[model samples]
Target: GLLPAMALLARTLALLAMTLAITAIKVVPLDMARDSFDDQYRGCSPAMMAVLPALHNFEFQVNPLFTQTWVKAEAEWRKRGSPVSPLASPAQAVALMAYTTKDIYKDFNAAVRVAGHSRQEYRNNFHFKTLHFLLTKQCHHVFRGVHDVRFQARRGQKVRFGQFTSTSLSKEVAQKYGTDTIFEVQTCHGVDIQAFSFYLSNQEVLIPPYETFKAVLETNDIGVALFLNLVLFFVHSLDHLGFPKLLPLSPHWKVSSVSPGLNVIVHSSGSFTIL
Candidate 1:
């Protein structure tokens, strides 16, 4: 935990240094995290943008590097008037930075999980909503027609990815992650970030969080569908077991007599119809 925290702090300090160099500012205190944002990232309303900086000094602290990347990317994105690069948008870069910072991402995910649906009901919700928008938008278009390459590994197991995933079109890269005991990832999503990525070759593709996923891939949809499916599954499984059912169940929640299973079919509308 200390190592990760120290790493994030180092990155944050690097970003702050970069900002200071660019602006030629004499002093920028850590408390002024909100002021660290460049004026260029105006894609979101002041209110929405406010949420990010507020995170720095509050209960949830984020890396300043992320905010800087977002600002720079957003400025470039707006100047181009369209998303030319996959990770050009501020939101997209921010998403990547957050994912890179393991601790922050984990904590953010936990908070979002706790908030659940009530978080969405708040029209003013910015932090989680912004991240949701960023990840979902970029993921939807990643790895369009690329054939899934077989890893040397076995059939079913987990493969861990670092902050910036290093992948390649070459099978050798895949083989590095594969093992005799571990199952190869048959289906995965990746994007060529050579244009935007630093010090990376064109042959390397960055594997995002949704790489192993086949369906309900978008982060937003997955979270909602998974939660709903679990709740419904738990209720129906109990009903089948002849246990006392919980009250305040949604009328729209169609209860089944089937045993607990996670066979959820997510529609394009982000609604899951479990069977």
Candidate 2:
């Protein structure tokens, strides 16, 4: 009689060899994924999601004791501040200059005409909208007594950045010049408040369907590799009793047209079944 036990022995050997030959291995870790620089150490730390019954704390923790070094010189800027053609904060200049004119609306129209020559989009967007909201929402008590100021930026027109920007801004500067709550909610991760400012001003609009490519990756990345590995593991299972791949991704295998059941006893070593 053909030995049913012997065939099981062969399949286990093949599986073990493949698992051992894999090129990379990694373990998933919990991380907080903080969104801004203003976040403080007292709050934004990572912890496991599972809730336990009682209060708990761990005393001993390992620290590698690594430190970073930097020169006294200015750090690299994320977004340039000085006047640049077209994009040199057309909105801010317009907003400020608009204040000096008797007819605010007429003054802004003229300012846009002057500034729009550089970059109509910036003139159109006006300081990315940060300082615009500073005027609205009663950002500071100082605005109350300043002047009877009235301004407008069209919110209708569409643009690539709903609030997102190709530009990056420092969290330090954003906090100083703009409201922390406004920028924190509107801005994306890393420095760059230009998009948020533009959005609030209603001058520029975010590109439709902008999120589809936000963090797109090529086939070479580690996340892709891990997914491919799982695919290989399932496709190569020649064993008659091995569980099907679909069953793992979904547990509703019993209702499906084709679903392989489990085998808990098969393990392979050299020539004999190891488990």
Candidate 3:
């Protein structure tokens, strides 16, 4: 018995060690995590970066548990007549737009323009024109007049079209035409594109009209529905077993009908004393 107990304890310790190891592997070092966040925030749109402090505060408000903490904190703060507002500032509105619209502009260059015919034919045909026109329209709409879009494309960047082969003539080409365009024609096949435009859209862009929020709320609804169903099932099971009716019965009575040789006694507080 002692040996078995020792083995069980060893197995539990091994499991705990394994769990801790896995957790440690998943957890990023604090400095590295902060640095990564800082990089992302820096890479974000200028409008978004302007109200970084407000965005940080707004993030806390969106969280239900965090909002509760904020409310309690505010209540305590207000006791000294120093009330704090939970609303995002006017500058944060622009930040919110930038934050939400970034997804639309993500991976702009990686977008593959599939053609029905050969590459040359596709370029010559109206299909290329139509595609370019659409892209130009989107660029104009999203960026407005902002033209300082800069991106660093590597020499051998892998994309859907194929590997991006860099050329020395990229600067000359950018100068010949204009950097106002979304992509600069670096070579016959490969193009150099702005990286900032790839991940930043217009300030006018708001989240897709509550569809995303609806999906998130629906997830919570599913969990609540399942929990309620489980509670109802348990309640139904107890009711089906005639637990409520049995509670009112006298303590001296024997419940021979439900189970043979079984004695059920009801206490003064509607509790069962089964023997």
Write down the lDDT of every candidate, Cα atoms only.
0.33, 0.21, 0.25
**Candidate 1 clash figure, as a count:** 5
Judged by whole-model lDDT over C-alpha atoms, candidate 3 comes out at 0.25
TM-score result, candidate 2: 0.15
- TM-score sort, best first: 1, 3, 2
Worst 10 residues of 2 by lDDT: 65-74
Estimate the lDDT of model 1. Answer: 0.33
Error of 1 at 171 (Å): 4.5
What TM-score, computed on C-alpha atoms, does each candidate reach? 0.30, 0.15, 0.16
lDDT of 2 by residue, 1-275 (tens): 46877788888988887565433233321111111011111121111111100100110011111000001000111132433233344432332222222223232233322322222332232321121111111011010000111111122211111212221123333333332111111222212223323232322211111211111111221221211000000111111322233322233212121112111121121111101
Off by over 4 Å in 2: 1-17, 21-24, 29-68, 71-187, 191-275
**Candidate 1's residue-wise lDDT over 73-191, tens digit each?**
54544554534454645556545444433334554444333332231321223244345334431222222111122122122222222112344454444344432111212223445
- What is the lDDT for 128 in model 3? 16
